[model samples]
Target: MQVTHAELVTSAVSPNQYPQDEIIEIALAGRSNVGKSSFINKMINRKGLARTSGQPGKTQTLNFYNINHQFRFVDVPGYGYARVAKTQRASWGKMIEKYLSQRENLQLVFLLMDFRHPPTELDIAMKEFVEELDIPYGIILTKSDKIKKSQWTRHLSLFKKDLDLPSVDALFPFSAESGEGSDLIWEIISDMIEA
Candidate 1:
Protein backbone atom coordinates (compact mmCIF):
# COMPACT_ATOMS: atom_id res chain seq x y z
CA MET A 1 0.00 0.00 0.00
CA GLN A 2 2.99 2.25 -0.03
CA VAL A 3 2.36 4.59 -2.93
CA THR A 4 5.78 5.33 -4.34
CA HIS A 5 4.54 6.69 -7.63
CA ALA A 6 1.20 8.32 -8.36
CA GLU A 7 0.51 10.53 -11.36
CA LEU A 8 -2.29 11.47 -13.73
CA VAL A 9 -1.89 9.31 -16.83
CA THR A 10 -4.60 10.76 -19.02
CA SER A 11 -7.98 12.47 -19.31
CA ALA A 12 -9.89 10.19 -21.63
CA VAL A 13 -13.28 10.81 -23.23
CA SER A 14 -13.64 7.40 -24.82
CA PRO A 15 -12.43 3.83 -24.62
CA ASN A 16 -9.79 4.41 -27.29
CA GLN A 17 -8.31 7.17 -25.14
CA TYR A 18 -7.97 4.97 -22.07
CA PRO A 19 -4.62 3.46 -21.15
CA GLN A 20 -3.97 0.28 -23.09
CA ASP A 21 -1.39 -1.28 -20.81
CA GLU A 22 -3.89 -3.75 -19.29
CA ILE A 23 -3.74 -2.18 -15.86
CA ILE A 24 -6.52 -2.82 -13.38
CA GLU A 25 -8.77 0.21 -12.87
CA ILE A 26 -10.80 1.29 -9.88
CA ALA A 27 -13.24 4.10 -10.55
CA LEU A 28 -14.60 6.91 -8.35
CA ALA A 29 -18.18 7.99 -8.93
CA GLY A 30 -20.30 10.52 -7.10
CA ARG A 31 -22.54 13.55 -7.37
CA SER A 32 -21.06 16.89 -8.32
CA ASN A 33 -19.24 18.63 -5.44
CA VAL A 34 -19.20 15.40 -3.43
CA GLY A 35 -15.41 15.46 -2.85
CA LYS A 36 -14.34 12.72 -5.30
CA SER A 37 -11.14 14.59 -6.06
CA SER A 38 -10.31 14.92 -2.39
CA PHE A 39 -10.83 11.17 -1.96
CA ILE A 40 -8.28 10.42 -4.70
CA ASN A 41 -5.79 12.93 -3.33
CA LYS A 42 -6.11 11.51 0.15
CA MET A 43 -5.76 7.96 -1.11
CA ILE A 44 -2.55 8.70 -2.95
CA ASN A 45 -1.18 10.73 -0.02
CA ARG A 46 -0.79 13.72 -2.29
CA LYS A 47 -2.32 17.19 -2.36
CA GLY A 48 -3.72 18.74 -5.54
CA LEU A 49 -3.05 15.65 -7.63
CA ALA A 50 -6.73 15.19 -8.51
CA ARG A 51 -7.55 18.93 -8.69
CA THR A 52 -10.21 19.71 -6.10
CA SER A 53 -12.52 22.41 -7.39
CA GLY A 54 -15.36 24.58 -6.11
CA GLN A 55 -17.23 24.23 -9.40
CA PRO A 56 -19.54 21.27 -9.83
CA GLY A 57 -19.18 18.98 -12.87
CA LYS A 58 -15.61 20.12 -13.44
CA THR A 59 -14.35 16.67 -14.44
CA GLN A 60 -15.64 15.99 -17.93
CA THR A 61 -13.44 13.00 -18.72
CA LEU A 62 -12.27 9.73 -17.21
CA ASN A 63 -9.06 10.77 -15.44
CA PHE A 64 -6.62 7.88 -15.20
CA TYR A 65 -4.13 8.05 -12.34
CA ASN A 66 -1.35 5.47 -12.35
CA ILE A 67 -0.65 4.06 -8.91
CA ASN A 68 2.57 2.20 -8.07
CA HIS A 69 2.71 1.05 -11.69
CA GLN A 70 0.30 -1.69 -10.68
CA PHE A 71 -3.20 -0.31 -11.18
CA ARG A 72 -5.08 2.89 -12.02
CA PHE A 73 -7.62 5.09 -10.31
CA VAL A 74 -10.16 6.29 -12.84
CA ASP A 75 -12.00 9.44 -11.73
CA VAL A 76 -15.27 9.46 -13.59
CA PRO A 77 -17.26 12.64 -14.17
CA GLY A 78 -19.45 13.81 -11.29
CA TYR A 79 -23.18 13.72 -11.87
CA GLY A 80 -26.31 15.84 -11.02
CA TYR A 81 -25.08 19.37 -11.70
CA ALA A 82 -28.06 21.50 -12.77
CA ARG A 83 -26.06 24.22 -14.50
CA VAL A 84 -24.73 21.95 -17.23
CA ALA A 85 -26.64 21.84 -20.52
CA LYS A 86 -29.01 18.93 -21.06
CA THR A 87 -27.12 17.65 -24.09
CA GLN A 88 -23.81 17.79 -22.24
CA ARG A 89 -25.29 15.94 -19.26
CA ALA A 90 -26.69 13.30 -21.56
CA SER A 91 -23.29 12.90 -23.22
CA TRP A 92 -21.63 12.49 -19.85
CA GLY A 93 -24.19 9.95 -18.77
CA LYS A 94 -23.68 7.93 -21.92
CA MET A 95 -19.91 8.07 -21.57
CA ILE A 96 -20.02 7.00 -17.92
CA GLU A 97 -22.42 4.17 -18.62
CA LYS A 98 -20.35 2.92 -21.53
CA TYR A 99 -17.12 2.91 -19.57
CA LEU A 100 -18.65 1.23 -16.54
CA SER A 101 -20.37 -1.46 -18.56
CA GLN A 102 -17.79 -2.17 -21.25
CA ARG A 103 -14.45 -1.84 -19.58
CA GLU A 104 -12.92 -5.23 -18.94
CA ASN A 105 -10.15 -4.19 -16.59
CA LEU A 106 -12.31 -2.13 -14.30
CA GLN A 107 -12.13 -3.91 -10.95
CA LEU A 108 -14.36 -1.85 -8.68
CA VAL A 109 -16.07 1.49 -8.10
CA PHE A 110 -16.03 3.67 -5.00
CA LEU A 111 -19.41 5.37 -4.87
CA LEU A 112 -18.91 8.49 -2.77
CA MET A 113 -21.79 10.12 -0.89
CA ASP A 114 -21.94 13.10 1.44
CA PHE A 115 -22.37 11.95 5.03
CA ARG A 116 -24.43 14.97 6.11
CA HIS A 117 -27.54 14.18 4.07
CA PRO A 118 -29.71 11.30 2.89
CA PRO A 119 -28.79 9.57 -0.33
CA THR A 120 -30.09 11.66 -3.21
CA GLU A 121 -32.29 10.30 -5.99
CA LEU A 122 -29.33 10.20 -8.35
CA ASP A 123 -27.33 8.28 -5.78
CA ILE A 124 -30.00 5.63 -5.50
CA ALA A 125 -30.27 5.38 -9.26
CA MET A 126 -26.52 4.98 -9.53
CA LYS A 127 -26.55 2.22 -6.93
CA GLU A 128 -29.22 0.38 -8.91
CA PHE A 129 -27.38 0.91 -12.17
CA VAL A 130 -24.14 -0.51 -10.83
CA GLU A 131 -26.04 -3.41 -9.36
CA GLU A 132 -27.66 -4.14 -12.69
CA LEU A 133 -24.25 -4.08 -14.30
CA ASP A 134 -22.97 -6.56 -11.72
CA ILE A 135 -20.00 -4.37 -10.98
CA PRO A 136 -18.17 -4.77 -7.69
CA TYR A 137 -18.47 -1.56 -5.70
CA GLY A 138 -18.29 0.04 -2.27
CA ILE A 139 -20.17 2.93 -0.72
CA ILE A 140 -17.97 5.61 0.81
CA LEU A 141 -19.60 8.12 3.15
CA THR A 142 -17.44 11.16 2.71
CA LYS A 143 -17.01 14.21 5.02
CA SER A 144 -17.35 12.07 8.12
CA ASP A 145 -15.33 14.65 10.04
CA LYS A 146 -18.26 17.02 9.82
CA ILE A 147 -20.49 14.62 11.76
CA LYS A 148 -20.42 13.62 15.40
CA LYS A 149 -19.13 10.20 16.48
CA SER A 150 -22.40 9.38 18.24
CA GLN A 151 -24.41 9.97 15.05
CA TRP A 152 -22.25 7.72 12.87
CA THR A 153 -24.30 4.62 13.57
CA ARG A 154 -27.59 6.33 12.84
CA HIS A 155 -26.27 7.87 9.64
CA LEU A 156 -24.85 4.55 8.44
CA SER A 157 -28.10 2.77 9.18
CA LEU A 158 -30.07 5.34 7.26
CA PHE A 159 -27.73 5.17 4.30
CA LYS A 160 -27.91 1.37 4.21
CA LYS A 161 -31.69 1.39 4.30
CA ASP A 162 -32.06 4.14 1.73
CA LEU A 163 -29.54 2.73 -0.71
CA ASP A 164 -30.62 -0.89 -0.20
CA LEU A 165 -26.94 -1.74 0.16
CA PRO A 166 -26.23 -5.42 0.52
CA SER A 167 -24.78 -6.58 3.83
CA VAL A 168 -21.74 -8.19 2.16
CA ASP A 169 -20.56 -5.05 0.41
CA ALA A 170 -18.05 -2.63 1.90
CA LEU A 171 -19.07 0.68 3.51
CA PHE A 172 -16.53 3.09 4.92
CA PRO A 173 -16.92 6.46 6.66
CA PHE A 174 -14.17 8.69 5.32
CA SER A 175 -12.76 12.18 5.79
CA ALA A 176 -10.22 13.50 3.32
CA GLU A 177 -9.37 16.33 5.72
CA SER A 178 -8.77 14.06 8.72
CA GLY A 179 -7.42 10.97 6.84
CA GLU A 180 -9.98 8.87 8.63
CA GLY A 181 -10.74 5.48 7.05
CA SER A 182 -7.89 5.88 4.56
CA ASP A 183 -6.09 2.76 5.74
CA LEU A 184 -9.22 0.65 5.68
CA ILE A 185 -10.07 1.93 2.25
CA TRP A 186 -6.60 1.12 1.04
CA GLU A 187 -6.87 -2.32 2.52
CA ILE A 188 -10.01 -2.94 0.54
CA ILE A 189 -8.44 -1.64 -2.65
CA SER A 190 -5.26 -3.62 -2.14
CA ASP A 191 -7.22 -6.76 -1.51
CA MET A 192 -9.20 -6.27 -4.69
CA ILE A 193 -6.07 -5.70 -6.70
CA GLU A 194 -4.34 -8.71 -5.24
CA ALA A 195 -7.32 -10.93 -5.69
Candidate 2:
Protein backbone atom coordinates (compact mmCIF):
# COMPACT_ATOMS: atom_id res chain seq x y z
CA MET A 1 0.00 0.00 0.00
CA GLN A 2 1.17 3.53 -0.74
CA VAL A 3 1.33 5.23 2.62
CA THR A 4 0.88 8.88 1.69
CA HIS A 5 0.21 9.72 5.32
CA ALA A 6 0.87 7.83 8.53
CA GLU A 7 0.83 9.17 12.06
CA LEU A 8 0.06 8.18 15.64
CA VAL A 9 -3.55 9.13 16.17
CA THR A 10 -3.92 8.10 19.80
CA SER A 11 -2.75 5.92 22.68
CA ALA A 12 -5.93 4.58 24.15
CA VAL A 13 -6.33 2.59 27.38
CA SER A 14 -10.09 2.27 27.06
CA PRO A 15 -12.66 1.85 24.31
CA ASN A 16 -13.93 5.39 24.78
CA GLN A 17 -10.50 6.65 23.73
CA TYR A 18 -10.53 4.76 20.41
CA PRO A 19 -11.14 6.67 17.23
CA GLN A 20 -14.87 6.98 16.58
CA ASP A 21 -14.57 7.22 12.83
CA GLU A 22 -15.84 4.54 10.43
CA ILE A 23 -12.33 3.40 9.44
CA ILE A 24 -11.33 -0.23 9.73
CA GLU A 25 -8.70 -1.37 12.26
CA ILE A 26 -5.98 -3.99 12.15
CA ALA A 27 -4.48 -5.06 15.48
CA LEU A 28 -1.02 -6.46 16.24
CA ALA A 29 -0.57 -8.80 19.20
CA GLY A 30 2.46 -10.70 20.43
CA ARG A 31 4.77 -11.40 23.34
CA SER A 32 7.02 -8.71 24.75
CA ASN A 33 10.28 -8.24 22.81
CA VAL A 34 8.71 -9.77 19.69
CA GLY A 35 9.63 -6.66 17.66
CA LYS A 36 6.05 -5.37 17.16
CA SER A 37 7.13 -1.73 17.12
CA SER A 38 9.81 -2.51 14.58
CA PHE A 39 7.29 -4.40 12.49
CA ILE A 40 4.94 -1.42 12.51
CA ASN A 41 7.71 0.98 11.53
CA LYS A 42 8.89 -1.26 8.73
CA MET A 43 5.43 -1.90 7.35
CA ILE A 44 4.69 1.83 7.27
CA ASN A 45 8.11 2.53 5.62
CA ARG A 46 8.96 5.04 8.33
CA LYS A 47 11.80 4.97 10.79
CA GLY A 48 11.02 5.71 14.47
CA LEU A 49 7.32 5.99 13.73
CA ALA A 50 6.47 3.25 16.23
CA ARG A 51 9.32 3.95 18.64
CA THR A 52 11.40 0.81 18.75
CA SER A 53 12.81 0.29 22.21
CA GLY A 54 15.33 -1.97 23.93
CA GLN A 55 12.97 -2.45 26.86
CA PRO A 56 10.31 -5.12 26.66
CA GLY A 57 6.69 -4.21 27.48
CA LYS A 58 7.30 -0.57 26.65
CA THR A 59 3.96 -0.22 24.83
CA GLN A 60 1.39 -0.07 27.61
CA THR A 61 -1.64 1.10 25.62
CA LEU A 62 -3.36 0.40 22.32
CA ASN A 63 -1.41 2.69 20.00
CA PHE A 64 -3.58 3.72 17.06
CA TYR A 65 -1.69 4.69 13.90
CA ASN A 66 -3.69 6.16 11.07
CA ILE A 67 -2.41 4.75 7.77
CA ASN A 68 -3.19 6.80 4.68
CA HIS A 69 -6.25 7.93 6.61
CA GLN A 70 -7.99 4.81 5.35
CA PHE A 71 -7.41 2.39 8.20
CA ARG A 72 -5.81 2.20 11.64
CA PHE A 73 -3.09 -0.08 12.92
CA VAL A 74 -3.66 -0.77 16.59
CA ASP A 75 -0.59 -1.94 18.46
CA VAL A 76 -1.90 -3.68 21.52
CA PRO A 77 0.32 -4.19 24.56
CA GLY A 78 2.68 -7.13 24.40
CA TYR A 79 2.05 -10.09 26.67
CA GLY A 80 4.29 -12.39 28.77
CA TYR A 81 6.62 -9.80 30.32
CA ALA A 82 7.79 -11.08 33.68
CA ARG A 83 9.11 -7.85 35.17
CA VAL A 84 5.68 -6.21 35.33
CA ALA A 85 3.61 -6.47 38.52
CA LYS A 86 0.93 -9.16 38.56
CA THR A 87 -1.90 -6.68 38.97
CA GLN A 88 -0.67 -4.59 36.07
CA ARG A 89 -0.40 -7.65 33.86
CA ALA A 90 -3.90 -8.71 34.80
CA SER A 91 -5.23 -5.29 33.94
CA TRP A 92 -3.50 -5.36 30.59
CA GLY A 93 -4.98 -8.74 29.86
CA LYS A 94 -8.47 -7.60 30.68
CA MET A 95 -8.09 -4.48 28.57
CA ILE A 96 -6.79 -6.38 25.59
CA GLU A 97 -9.43 -9.07 25.89
CA LYS A 98 -12.22 -6.54 26.07
CA TYR A 99 -10.98 -4.71 22.99
CA LEU A 100 -10.56 -7.90 20.97
CA SER A 101 -13.96 -9.24 21.89
CA GLN A 102 -15.96 -6.05 21.59
CA ARG A 103 -14.43 -4.02 18.78
CA GLU A 104 -16.65 -3.94 15.69
CA ASN A 105 -14.36 -2.16 13.23
CA LEU A 106 -11.48 -4.52 13.93
CA GLN A 107 -11.08 -6.32 10.60
CA LEU A 108 -7.98 -8.39 11.19
CA VAL A 109 -5.37 -9.28 13.82
CA PHE A 110 -1.73 -10.00 13.03
CA LEU A 111 -0.38 -12.28 15.73
CA LEU A 112 3.40 -11.89 15.81
CA MET A 113 5.65 -14.75 16.91
CA ASP A 114 9.42 -15.21 17.11
CA PHE A 115 10.76 -17.14 14.15
CA ARG A 116 13.92 -18.26 15.95
CA HIS A 117 12.07 -20.30 18.57
CA PRO A 118 9.00 -22.43 19.00
CA PRO A 119 5.70 -20.72 19.74
CA THR A 120 5.45 -19.88 23.44
CA GLU A 121 2.50 -20.84 25.61
CA LEU A 122 1.18 -17.30 25.51
CA ASP A 123 1.33 -17.36 21.73
CA ILE A 124 -0.67 -20.56 21.54
CA ALA A 125 -3.21 -19.28 24.01
CA MET A 126 -3.57 -16.05 22.05
CA LYS A 127 -4.23 -17.95 18.82
CA GLU A 128 -6.87 -20.01 20.55
CA PHE A 129 -8.44 -17.02 22.24
CA VAL A 130 -8.80 -15.08 19.00
CA GLU A 131 -10.22 -18.10 17.26
CA GLU A 132 -12.70 -18.63 20.05
CA LEU A 133 -13.79 -15.04 19.68
CA ASP A 134 -14.33 -15.64 15.94
CA ILE A 135 -11.84 -12.95 15.06
CA PRO A 136 -10.22 -13.13 11.62
CA TYR A 137 -6.47 -13.41 12.28
CA GLY A 138 -3.13 -14.48 10.83
CA ILE A 139 0.33 -15.25 12.14
CA ILE A 140 3.43 -13.27 11.30
CA LEU A 141 6.71 -14.90 12.24
CA THR A 142 9.09 -12.00 12.90
CA LYS A 143 12.91 -11.86 12.75
CA SER A 144 13.13 -14.34 9.90
CA ASP A 145 16.53 -12.96 9.00
CA LYS A 146 17.88 -14.29 12.27
CA ILE A 147 17.44 -17.84 11.02
CA LYS A 148 18.88 -19.65 8.01
CA LYS A 149 16.75 -19.95 4.88
CA SER A 150 17.00 -23.72 4.97
CA GLN A 151 15.39 -23.83 8.40
CA TRP A 152 12.33 -21.87 7.35
CA THR A 153 10.37 -24.95 6.39
CA ARG A 154 11.12 -26.67 9.67
CA HIS A 155 10.13 -23.64 11.69
CA LEU A 156 6.91 -23.23 9.72
CA SER A 157 6.04 -26.85 10.25
CA LEU A 158 6.66 -26.58 13.96
CA PHE A 159 4.45 -23.52 14.19
CA LYS A 160 1.60 -25.22 12.36
CA LYS A 161 1.87 -28.33 14.48
CA ASP A 162 2.14 -26.54 17.78
CA LEU A 163 -0.43 -23.85 17.10
CA ASP A 164 -2.77 -26.07 15.10
CA LEU A 165 -3.26 -23.20 12.76
CA PRO A 166 -6.59 -23.20 10.97
CA SER A 167 -6.45 -23.99 7.27
CA VAL A 168 -8.14 -20.72 6.47
CA ASP A 169 -5.55 -18.67 8.33
CA ALA A 170 -2.32 -17.51 6.68
CA LEU A 171 1.23 -17.37 8.05
CA PHE A 172 4.03 -15.22 6.72
CA PRO A 173 7.73 -15.19 7.62
CA PHE A 174 8.79 -11.60 8.08
CA SER A 175 12.05 -9.71 8.71
CA ALA A 176 11.72 -6.05 9.60
CA GLU A 177 15.46 -5.43 9.21
CA SER A 178 15.83 -7.04 5.79
CA GLY A 179 12.47 -5.96 4.35
CA GLU A 180 11.64 -9.52 3.58
CA GLY A 181 7.95 -10.48 3.39
CA SER A 182 6.90 -6.83 3.63
CA ASP A 183 5.27 -6.71 0.23
CA LEU A 184 3.41 -9.96 0.75
CA ILE A 185 2.24 -8.84 4.16
CA TRP A 186 0.96 -5.61 2.67
CA GLU A 187 -0.86 -7.46 -0.07
CA ILE A 188 -2.57 -9.63 2.50
CA ILE A 189 -3.59 -6.65 4.59
CA SER A 190 -4.82 -4.72 1.59
CA ASP A 191 -6.85 -7.66 0.37
CA MET A 192 -8.52 -8.08 3.74
CA ILE A 193 -9.32 -4.40 3.96
CA GLU A 194 -10.69 -4.27 0.46
CA ALA A 195 -12.70 -7.42 0.89
- Candidate 2 Cα deviation (angstroms), residue 2: 1.3
Which stretches of model 1 miss by more than 4 angstroms? none
| Residue 154 C-alpha lDDT in model 2 | 86
Query: lDDT of candidate 2?
Result: 0.92
RMSD of each: 1.0, 1.2
What TM-score would you give candidate 2 relative to the actual structure? 0.97
TM-score of each: 0.97, 0.97
Per-residue error (Å), model 1, residue 81: 0.5
Summing lDDT over every window of 10 consecutive residues in candidate 2, give the lowest-scoring window. 164-173
Which consecutive 10 residues in model 1 have the weakest lDDT in total?
163-172
Per-model C-alpha lDDT, please? 0.92, 0.92
Query: What stretches of model 2 exceed 4 Å from their correct place?
Result: 166-169
lDDT (10s digit) by residue, model 2, range 28-117: 999999999999999988999999889898999999999998889999999999999999999999999999999998989999999999
